[model samples]
Target: MSDHTIPHIGAAWREVVADLFEMTKPKVVLVMLITVWVGMALTPIGAIPWLAVIAGNIGIAALAGAGAAFNHILDEHIDQKMARTHKRPVATGRISRRAGLSFAGFLSVFGFSVLMIFTNALTAWLTLFSMVGYALVYTAYLKRATPQNIVIGGLAGAMPPLLGWTAITGHVMGLPLLLVLIIFAWTPPHFWALAIHRRDDYARAKIPMMPVTHGIAFTRIQVWLYSWLLLSVSMLPVALGALGGIYALSALLLGARFLQWSYWLLYEKKPDAPWGMFKYSISYLMILFIMMLVDHFTWSWLVSIIFPNI
Candidate 1:
């Protein structure tokens, strides 16, 4: 090949590779991984196994990526119709359906295998179930079916914490469920804020997002309500004694800010309010989980320092 032709081919190959990576929705996968790590960290397993934790995290990331890829494939038509998603790899035909499917299949197999080998069968199966729940049940059916799609579909997305817990302990029980509940309660407000901002995009796609189906005014109220619900649910860890004062304080402060943003979204006339709330919600969850990890490690020391008599 000519030198110029070789350079052109190399650049084209790089673009394709980048597009493939984009189809995996790396940002979402990253957030999920953080929750997974926090879940594993909070588990009371003595003499933690760093190697298995690393491997388990890899497996969960792979599974989450595969689910995202499947979503890209399934939502191509809907994506092409929406302005924000019109340039997506599958939507724009930069990645073909066969290639996307093959990539997803490879990830699913690799992730499940990794979990089974390094974690345990329970974690592996639960991860697979979550993948299918998102890729098939949520993306394919629930998304197009109703205005309450996110509320219902949030379960699968909220499983990462529980998956993390099971990865280390090989069991699913109380604390993990509370962790899952926090994310579950947080999901509706988090997603609905974005849905409100992208109301027109979902309208154009003919997807029945809350703002499109229930109207933006009604959706804003729901966001406000769910924000309150999230605040309450987030405090449950402290109440149940799964977490302590540090995490409790973090949740209260973070949740108060989240509630304030949602209130602004509800009452304000500014177009940017919804997007602003959406961004804050992401930070809220991240910081909340990090605080959980911090409190998990430092609670006893902090309590001793503060309440020496007790």
Candidate 2:
């Protein structure tokens, strides 16, 4: 191969890989995995199944990626009409619709196989359900059909921690449900913040996002309402004794900050970019889950020291 040809080949290969990865929407998958990992770690059970943790991460990432790819394929037309997403691989024709569908199928099959093999059937099934709910239901129908789309579709996105818990515990539990509720409540404010920032993009695409459908004021009020509810829901775990002071304190403080941000978004002078709350919402969930993980280990260590034996 000629030297120039070699660099061309390398560039082509990099572009191909990048397009494929972009179809999966890896940034969203990262937060999903963190929630799953934290849920796995915080399982109150026998010695941690290290294998399940590793396998669960891989499986969840694959399925989440698959679902995102499916979304790309479904939303390509609308994506092209939006400033924020016009350059998506599928939208821009870098990845063909047929190719995107194939990739999504491959990821789903691989993820499902890994989940069934490494974890339990229930975990695999639940993950599959969430993926389908997002890719098929949310992306295809809910997004176009209603302004309340994210609020309802958020259930699918909120399942990760529960998936993680079931991977390790082989059964669902109350605490994991609490995790799901917190995320479900958080998703609205998170998404509505971005929707406010991108309301024009949504309008251009003819998608009925909250800000586009109900107007910015109504959407802003919804963000505040959901953020307040999220703050209350986040405390449920600590209140019920699933978590202790460290986690509870952290949840309260972080949630207070989230509410404060929501307040600014709703009440303060309008800014050029209205995505401040969107950025903080992501960090809020990540840190809140991390606090829960830390609380679990801290409690475990204290118990081991204080009790020493039954």
Candidate 3:
């Protein structure tokens, strides 16, 4: 091939790689990884296994990416009809369904292998269940079946902390379960804000998202209610003595901001309020988990300094 043709071929390959990466929904995968880190970190393991932590996290990310790719294949038709998702790689035919499926299969096998080798059988199995939960159960059935789809489907997305904890301890524990509960309670408000923003797209696609099925006004009320619910659930860790004062204070402050945005979305009804809430919710969850880690590590040291006599 001529030099000019070689450059053109390289550019084409680059574009193809980018498209494949897009199918994995990297942004969502990133959030999953952060929660997983928090889960593993909060475990009471005496010595950290850095190698397993790194390898297992890579495995978890791969599985998450695989699930997202599967979602691209299954939701292509719905994605094509929705303005927000119409330009997705599968929907746009930039990557065919068969290619997407093969990619997902590869990721699933690779991720499961890595987890089993580096982590444990339990972690591997649990991660696989989460993949199936998201890719097959939620994407294929629940999403199209009911307006409460996200509520039920939220468990899959919320499983990373448990998976992370199990990777370290090879079993379930109360703290990890509490972490899962926080995410589960947070999902509705987080998603409903986006659904309200994209209500027209969902309506056009005939997807029964909360705003589409129940009306935006009703969905807004649900968002408001769920925000309070999230705040309440967030306190459970501290109440159970699993977390500390630092995390409790962080939760209250972060949750207050979430409630503030939710309040605006409900009463103020600014056209941009829903989008603002959607954006903030993402940051809120990430920061909340990071604070949990911070609190977990530093609380004893701080208490010792504050009350030297005690």
Candidate 4:
């Protein structure tokens, strides 16, 4: 091919790759992958089966991406109206609705197939429920209908770790359920922080976010309430003897920081305060999960070193 043709072809290929990546909502998928990995690593019975774990991870990630894409599809009109979401692929018209929906369908089928074939039926079914919960119930209905959407819909987001636990053990138990509860409790404060910052955008889009409908003061109070609940929930592993004192200390410190930020967001009226709370909330959850995984592995290492017999 001529030099001019080569550059044209390369540009076209790059666009194609970009469009495909956009369909997967790559950043969100990355978060799902990390949490699932942490869940598998924190299991007490040594390393999980690699093949099943990897297969389940891929399926879960794909399903999450598909749901995000379908959300963009359903919310395209609203997204286009909101400054925060106006530049999304669907909203920008870079990807047609038909193409986006088709991609979503393909991803859902492939992901469900991987889960069923490589993992157990239970994992497969749970994953399917997660997809529907996010794509249909949360995105299509609850998001527009009520300010409590994320609270109800968070069950789907919180399922990844449980899915990972089940994929390894082929059953659910107290520990995995605790992990699920951690994410569930973490969800409201996390998203509410973002909604607090984006209240104007949500209001313009006519979505009934807590801050938009119930007013900022009410939403701020809810953020503080949820933050406290999350802190209590985070201590459960330590209380159950699943973790060591180190984990308890970490939880105390992290939860304190989380509450401090939420408290400021609740009481302060600074222009930058909402943004600060939003950033801190993400860090708060990420660090909490990281500390959990680290505490688990570190405690195990210490026991092995000190005992050297058991």
Candidate 5:
């Protein structure tokens, strides 16, 4: 082959590999895995099946990543138009549509098989649902159809804790439901803050994000409203005795900070303000979940120390 053809083939191979890796949406999967692990750790049951947990988490992460990959495939056209997404493998012509789809399919199959073989059928089924929700319903329909898309699509994102909870217990309960509710409520504010910052990019892509379709002022109001709702939802675990005072205090403090940031976004019309809130929202969720995990272990250790007889 000529030198020019050699370079083209080498670049094609590199792009194919990168596209395959990107199918996993590794960063998002990492956070999801952490939250799921927290759920597994916090469950009142003793002696979780370590291998099962690991396998299940890997499967969940793969499913999430594959779903995101498929999203990129489906959204490549719009992605090409959006400044933030134009350089993605699919959008940039680094990977072909067929290649992206095949990689996504492979990951999805592998993930589902792992969950089915190593974990319960329910978890596998739920994971499949989440994959389809994100890849098909959310990406193909909700993303451009309506501003309320995230609200509806957030259910899939909120399922991780429950997936983890059920991975161990094989059933859902009030406590795990509370985790789901917290994430569900948190999603709008968490995403809208970013959407506000990326509104122009979204508009340029002809995507109807809330900030693009309904105006930034309206989106700001929704962000603040959802922030308050998330704060209230975060308190449920403590109220229901699923968590102790330490968790309660931490949740309250974090919730306050989250609300403060939302309030800042609501009032601050400057372009940069939403970006700050957007970044904080990511940190807020991760920290809040970490605090919950910490509080769980701390309270259990204190109880053991104080009440040795029990």
Candidate 6:
């Protein structure tokens, strides 16, 4: 081959390699990491250990990616039925099952080692369980067995924040559980919105998503109801004295907007679109976590400056 042809071939191979990496669903892993980071940030002013934070986030992200890869492998048949996922590397045969599972095993082992070495053993073990919960219990079983799949399976997805908190504190506590609860409440609406758009695909796959099992009307009502529940849960931080005015104000506004949009989704004769809500749900969670960080830092500073004697 000519020199120019060699370069072109190299670029093509690199693109294929990139496509393989996409199988791990890195963007979803990043969202999980963001929550973990925020959870670490929420530790009382002097409690955070930066080294553990870094190690824990990296390890958790790797395991989360491994779990996602397992999901891709297990859902391959159903994945092929959905237009959105039909081209996945595993589904398209660009990645073989043995290769995919091997990659997942490698990631899981490496992630576990890092967490055990750099963070506490508690964090390492909990994160390992989360990976199994998401990949085996949620993806392989609950997802196919129930229309309430996302609702029940969401526990695995909601665990990163708690893992993050424990990484820092080396123990479990109420605040971390509250964060888990907030994410748990947010999961159904976040996912069901997309499920609405893909109802036909799910029906064809026999996956029993909410829209497939309960019909769109019922699913929309559930979304609206869950949005309200999420809003109520968002305020618990303020009520419990865990967060401050900044988080309170931000949560109220974000949750209200979420509730309003969900109401429109429920009652509108023909709603504008549900995809935007799906997209916004991702943004909403990230922003909510940011507000928590902002609240903690700013409020802690304010309290110190305003009432030095206290």
Candidate 1, after superposition: displacement of residue 125 in Å? Answer: 0.7
> Can you list the residue pairs that collide in candidate 3?
none
* Highest lDDT scorer: 3
Candidates in order, TM-scores: namely 0.95, 0.97, 0.96, 0.95, 0.94, 0.95
lDDT of each: 0.92, 0.91, 0.93, 0.85, 0.86, 0.89
Q: Name the 10 consecutive residues with the lowest summed lDDT in model 2.
A: 268-277
Per-residue CA lDDT of model 6 for 54-82, tens digit only, reads: 89888898889889989989999999999
What is candidate 1's lDDT per residue for 1-310, written digit by digit as tens? 8889999999999998899899889998999999999989888777989877988999999999999999999999999988888999999999999999999999999999999999899999999999999999999999999888888999999999999999999999898899899999999999999999999999989889989988988989999999999999999989988888889999999999998998899997566999999999999999999999889879766777899987
Candidate 5 residue pairs in backbone clash: 24-65
TM-score of 5: 0.94
| Per-residue lDDT of model 2, residues 1-310, tens digit only | 7889999999998998899998888888998889998888878777778888888889989999999999999998999998889999999998898888889999999999999999999999999999999999999999999999999999999999999999998998898999999999999999989999999999999999988989999988888899889999999998898899999899889999988888888885547335777888889989999998888899989999999993
Model 6 collision count: 0
Higher-ranked by TM-score: 2 or 3: 2
What is the per-residue lDDT of model 3 for residues 118-191, given as tens digits with 9 covering 90 to 100? Answer: 88999999999999999999999999999999999999999999999999989998889999999999998999
Q: TM-score: which is higher, 1 or 6?
A: 1
* Clashing residue pairs found in predicted model 2: none
If ranked by lDDT, best first, what sequence of candidates would result?
3, 1, 2, 6, 5, 4
Residue 284, candidate 6: Cα error in Å is 0.9
Off by over 4 Å in 2: 1-3, 270-273
Q: Please report how far candidate 4 places residue 58 from its true position, in Å.
A: 1.3
Candidate 5 per-residue lDDT over residues 47-160, each given as its tens digit = 769877988898888888889899989999998887778888888877888988888898899999988889888889998998899899999999989999999999999889
**Winning model by TM-score:** 2
**In candidate 5, how many clashes are counted?**
1
